[model samples]
Target: MANKIISQRISPHLWFEHQAEEAAKFYTSIFPNSSIGRISHYTEAGHEIHGMPAGSVLTVEFTLDGQTFIALNGGPLFKFNEAISFLVNCQTQEEIDYYWDKLRAGGDPKADQCGWLKDKFGLSWQVAPVQIAEMLVDKDQERLSRVMNAVFRMKKLDLKAIEAAYGEPVGAK
Candidate 1:
């Protein structure tokens, strides 16, 4: 299982003060193509920690968007802030809306097209599309300026409004 583990994994570990397993399940349910993989506790059927009953979960591995994550029930040495975030590259407006609303279900948006928001777990994420970056650097200066102006004031990236700002076809330059 060593080779198999290394070959298909980029796991971002989360250290939860408590409820690592609960958080794992929460995340898996929210994201598409995700689920709980493995859950192991401190007190096994025939084992113990520090010669006492440490009945908490030692580790919980979860899969989200085909990516693996391991949450440890470590003591609260640190907590998640906005220091690290995940970027979701969306292809369509519908895709953008779905993730934006859901991911930010209990979170708030930051500034501009570079959308930043926190989940219920206080984990930050940036939900954007390739088109957004593309639009900003469009060949038409007027279109570029207008789109840039609009995004500077928006919490969520609006595709239709961006297109309207152009008022003409702007090639991806």
Candidate 2:
């Protein structure tokens, strides 16, 4: 065992069968102020996996919300599922709608209220508005009930209905 290992303070590692570049581009585009760094590969690193194809971009580094992700093309022995998810604190109904529409292009959506949906790449995302926290945790049971009911009845969130249910103006204080 090597005594010196790389730093582990900042970055997530993502493994893909062959869509490393594609996924990196997709994620960087979806999130604001994000970008992908240089990508490279190794032909023979020794041991059993040696003589692997070179120039295939074995790794990639990208940033989303200033967080880094390293994508590796390690073949199809594994995959991504609902076990992990990224949450976006969307501000406008349009923002939530935008993500819901774009990310769900070839993915799936589950049951209501939680904003739990899968993106085209099988990655899960929580597309929610900033107001949901307040509505869910509100001391007024009636308001919370109304909000939950309103949420269950729709595919995409109807901000107006939620606000109406809450008896508060849209984007309330």
Off by over 4 Å in 1: 1-6, 43-53, 108-114, 136-144, 166-173
Q: Which candidate is the best by TM-score?
A: 2
- Residue-wise C-alpha lDDT for candidate 2, range 7-47, written one tens digit per residue: 54966787788788899888888778787876777665642
What Cα-based lDDT does every candidate model obtain? 0.72, 0.75
Per-candidate TM-scores read 0.74, 0.79
Model 2, which residues run further than 4 Å from truth?
A: 1-8, 50-52, 109-114, 169-173
Each model's total of backbone clashes: 0, 0
Candidate 2: clashing pairs of residues: none
Cα lDDT for residue 163, model 1? 65
Q: Compared with the true structure, what per-residue lDDT tens digits does model 1 show for residues 1-173?
A: 21234245467998887778878877777678887776767764545333323676877878788888888876666788878888888877888898888777755444223466787766787887667777776677987788878776667777777667766544523
